[model samples]
Target: MARVVTKPDTLNQLNQDFEQQVLTVPVFLNSVPKCGTHLIRNIFRMFVPVNQQYHDTFIQIPVLRQHVGAFNYLQPKLSWGHLLFSDESAMALRKAQHLVVVRDPYDWVLARARFFLSDNFQGNLEHLKSGQINLEEILNMMIFGIHEKVPSLSDIYTHNAAAWLGTGTKLVRFEELKHHVQNLESDDAEQYFRELLSVLQLREFPTDWRERVRVGSDREQSGTYRDNLTNTAFTLPDQLPEQQRKLVDYAAPGLRNLLGYCD
Candidate 1:
């Protein structure tokens, strides 16, 4: 039997029933940088209907507020962003089903470094590209946020998971989701997606949509954090420059214990 490709319009028509689904408030998917923000966005794209307009980053959204007239009527909305939490953001999130994702900080930092080097990223790349700094110095700048007391691109890497998400946000580890989605061969794959759906209160995702999710795109280029350092000589401790190490120690206190990065 030939497989029929469903047109976007056809799929949108079929998904209209889900549009009217009851959600008491908007849905928010927020995360740490390099913590699978795109992964959740894909999930939302497949599961959420077209009529809904979800905000990816509340703060980044220009000139919008809690009582914005257009947003009030966009029922059952979903949003995702990489913004750090603040009192104002938290207050705005109170009315939404907010979720957060975190990864081992070491791994997050390493992946971010590679991503920073990519041509399309367009973030502050001069330091990473500079011939003067070794990988360790670059990692130090990223982890500690300063190289010689000047703020570096590594400033983005200083987020503490607990501090960023605060008290009310629900957290999921990046490894857990990556493991399940990337391993379709596993018998538990379906169960894992179901578990995610349940957690997010999204009851309408198409059952076979798992096969459509492009898990291949998620494969880590250098593999894990330690593997990312294979070409370089430094281990995790040696990765951070002396001053940067002190800054990291202060910035992410208890993060090592919290995220089980001890190994």
Candidate 2:
């Protein structure tokens, strides 16, 4: 099993600082593995009471059956995970308000490569961290994946994001989420969040929505945040290289378009 080393966040304690509402319906924040899972989860944490938030596990396919109660409509909780599209998952989320978060494939490749190379991630690919493989090779591995080891980008996106579309799951783009968080003072940001949080079915949007978002969106609280990653030997490019970007398109084909990242 792969392990991610993330520092404990104060959001649970900070959540007390706000007047939270009990969730009337279960809410699931599903996403492609590297597509700002914590960012969306953290923001929602501020609006929900601590006890109503599922802290049992990250809720993946393997242990989903055990945590099926996270989606219990009668005991509604705010849960998040990398659940793929399947009969089991579809049934599990049948009674919940589902939100799927995704990032542009071009950028997802970079994020995956960076996380795998960082000391914070300990998994089978730890061998790649020895600098034996060049950055390009690592990036390629992220796209096509290591044979029989990591799953390819297309496989991950197809099941995790694409297939879930048109299934009534609301799509939330990482870029748009981050943009609104960064510009909370603007009317556009206000409207953006109102729409985003609409799935939660809060009786009324809180007056201090901006402050809650600011606290929840803090990069320092995110262990997987790019700058927060530790002992990263290589300096990753701010944008994907043209060659690698083309490789993403080739590997995933219509992925970016399916996720509304491209025309």
Candidate 3:
């Protein structure tokens, strides 16, 4: 664990006070890209309007404080981003009850591949605009840089899950949220949803909450990569490259074994 550099005067009281304040402060939801981030956001929208914030890198403390200070206070703020933990981000997390979502890295990679393939994806990167790249190429691009310009894929996904692994942060399983789909029409589903809300300390939802959630979710979005690759007669990788494998391990310790995705 790395030591968080803070002011000397507040060093002793910081951790204690941070833990106490987290429970009451707003929810800060963050996740690796294509990891059911929008699904969680949609669910939260039922209770409170989800505010969008895009801090793509490891932000410094003073700048992060200023960014957070500018958030709209008319409603409960839900600041989200695809950011990894750093001293600055850790400091920002202090003021909010943050939740991070993780998915099987294999699935996560596939989703990103599919996303970039879409013509609607407004990426300025050359690889993204071509639409001729394969899944393997996509993985290569993410791990190694694209033309040595954009940040590497590992730069983002490596230690991505680790960013939110510390104390006072909640981990939401993408699998659990997906399972909710099966029981969406049943009373047990409402109970499950309620349990989720309880975890976030949110208020009770309306009687028609399930319908609202369903309408908000894009059920067809999750497995697009599989469908696309199957149609093109492409095969999934037997194993990730050494660099990519390490990235996943760093982001999610023992993820394959934990998720039963290991060979």
Candidate 4:
């Protein structure tokens, strides 16, 4: 489908793209879904109060173009929509420290696919289990970008690396830090927060935010998609048909191995 070319998406996307030219003034968080970004964003929001001093934009709707505009002066934290590598989004990503969040694609896919059953998704979030759609349609859409890349984060890893591959910025995996900041069994979570805070350069974290670091999440699990996934919840990678598997392999090779699925 051709893009809508509407004013806002185009304008915001364009603004976001332009803002990438600035330096370490803005730290871009290119997040793939289910990638532990919520926890990190919450920590940043809670630590850096949005009073007159700082502005924290985490998952702002419509587009993050407005927040990206603040790239001129150094801000303690900045978070937003995925930083795709289109000619439009190239600017802000170029000067960013390039901290991206990734998840095992298989698990991530399964977790989202289950959204069909949720009341919140309504009919638009179609699924065979929801009784509002056919399995073939969903499968076909997944195999092909049949409708659009609504759910795909779009070459985010490549986008982050394109501007600063050799630079000193780091990429964090969702799975690695899942328990790092939330498992309350030991002293590890505190140490993890200190390390994470140091990385974002936040001096003091809100007391509640610090308490939540090793506790629960800001929202319920996006894992609701699990109910409708056909095979094993964790290993849907193997259940995908051959063509689908090959297609996924072509689009994201690293993801196949990361999710531990056998084609």
Candidate 5:
């Protein structure tokens, strides 16, 4: 298994600051890897009681059966994972409200490459992080993937996001989530969150929702937040290069459009 080194967050301690509501149905925050998983998970943590939050592990296919209790509807919990679409996963989440988060493929390529090269990520690809590989090559590896070591952009998005599209899972775009978090005071942001939180089935949106969101979205609290990543040697381009952007399209045709990221 790949190891990710992230600092323990005080969100649990912070979670106590709010009057949390017990969930009636299990709420699963599913996402493509690197699609603001921590940011969304942390925000939901603030709204749910710590006792009801699944702290076991980030549930995935291989170890899913072991942690299937995270989706228990009777003793509801708030859980999150990079779960791919599968018979077992579909069955497990049958009684749970599932939210599948995704990012624009163009930006997702950049995010994936950035993390793979950071000190926080210790995996088989460490050889590529020796500064021997140039930025463009690393970005290409992110798009096409490393032979058997990493799954390609198409593979990840296909099973993780695309396949789950019509299944009753709520699609949450990372870009939209970030925008609302940045403008929480606006009426539009309020409506965005109201709908987002509706899956939780909270009796009523809490009065302190804004403050909870503010603390949960704090960049310092997320270990994987771009600026928080340590020892990222490459100076990645702000946007994917035009050629690489073309490569992304070829790698995952119509992905951006399907995910509502159309130009």
Candidate 6:
């Protein structure tokens, strides 16, 4: 794993002391990769009344002191990016009562595929084509949903979801959001989410929250990669060997499951 770069003189003692300071309810909105984290950030930005700083990546979440520097410095609340549930993050979540919004594994992987295929991550292209990983095969799982007790898309999704679900953390699913929003219920996805912000005591919700509803919606249409993710080839007896399957399974069960498979 890569390092969390920021550290100061007497860093260990300082962080230990800081962690003990009993931080007020801080919002540690972990923007999961390709999980409509953008929409979530936008929604939170609407509620937080004061100026805030945000990062383009997850590296900042674990080292809050270096970037956000405790909630006391924050005008209202700060939204952050995808972070693994390490002790530093756990401490922040404990302080803030962070709400985790999880997309069904299928959709999660599909969105990731779009981002993965985009130009920003060109460095990964060589590895993927070399079979160090296979982005195309993995994405098909996103067309459907994760299945239990079997080989699936990437294993990473399944394992990752299991970690999130298994933890005592509070998680809300994207499906619930989609159904509620599409049905136009009184307690729609937007409303459900706004309530979380309120629970975190965000006095102001962006009026634009309503507008995000339209911008956030996605429908799975036929033959449309932009809409419908084509089913992935997770049933890998057809192409992948046992060793390869196990490799992917061990490295990325949650990722696989997110693509809607159980390998």
Task: Give each model's clash number.
Answer: 2, 0, 1, 7, 0, 33
* lDDT per residue (tens digit) for residues 46-85 in model 1: 5565556454333323333643332242465766665555
TM-score of model 1 relative to the true fold? 0.67
Ranked candidates, highest lDDT first: 5, 2, 3, 1, 4, 6
Model 4 off-target regions past 4 Å?
1-25, 52-65, 74-77, 86-90, 93-97, 122-140, 147-168, 185-191, 203-247, 256-263
- Taking all chains together, each candidate's TM-score versus the true structure is 0.67, 0.98, 0.64, 0.59, 0.99, 0.54
Model 2 spans with C-alpha error above 4 angstroms:
none
Give lDDT tens digits, candidate 4, residues 137-198.
Answer: 45445434335434442343345333433445465666656666556455776676666555
Model 4 is weakest, by summed lDDT over 10 consecutive residues, at 2-11
Candidate RMSDs in order? 8.8, 0.9, 11.5, 9.4, 0.7, 11.7
Which is the better candidate, 3 or 5, if ranked by TM-score?
5
Please report, in order, the local distance difference test score of every candidate based on alpha carbons: 0.54, 0.93, 0.55, 0.45, 0.94, 0.45
Higher-TM-score candidate among 1 and 4? 1
lDDT of 6 by residue, 35-116 (tens): 5554455434434433342333443444554644434333334656656555665555564545465664444545555533
Off by over 4 Å in 3: 1-24, 49-66, 70-75, 128-135, 143-154, 186-188, 203-207, 218-255, 258-263
TM-score of 2: 0.98
User: Best candidate per lDDT, number?
Assistant: 5
Q: Write the per-residue lDDT of candidate 3 for residues 1-263, one digit (tens) a residue.
A: 21212112211222222211122235666787667876676555445432222333223333566566423333335556555777667665665667777776766665655555454343454355454776666766655556654555555554556545656767777777778855698777787788666644644445666765665454433233234222222344555666666765665466556434565
Output the TM-score of candidate 5.
Answer: 0.99
User: What value of lDDT does candidate 6 attain over all alpha carbons?
Assistant: 0.45
Where does model 5 exceed 4 Å of error?
Answer: none
Clashing pairs in 5: none
lDDT of 3: 0.55
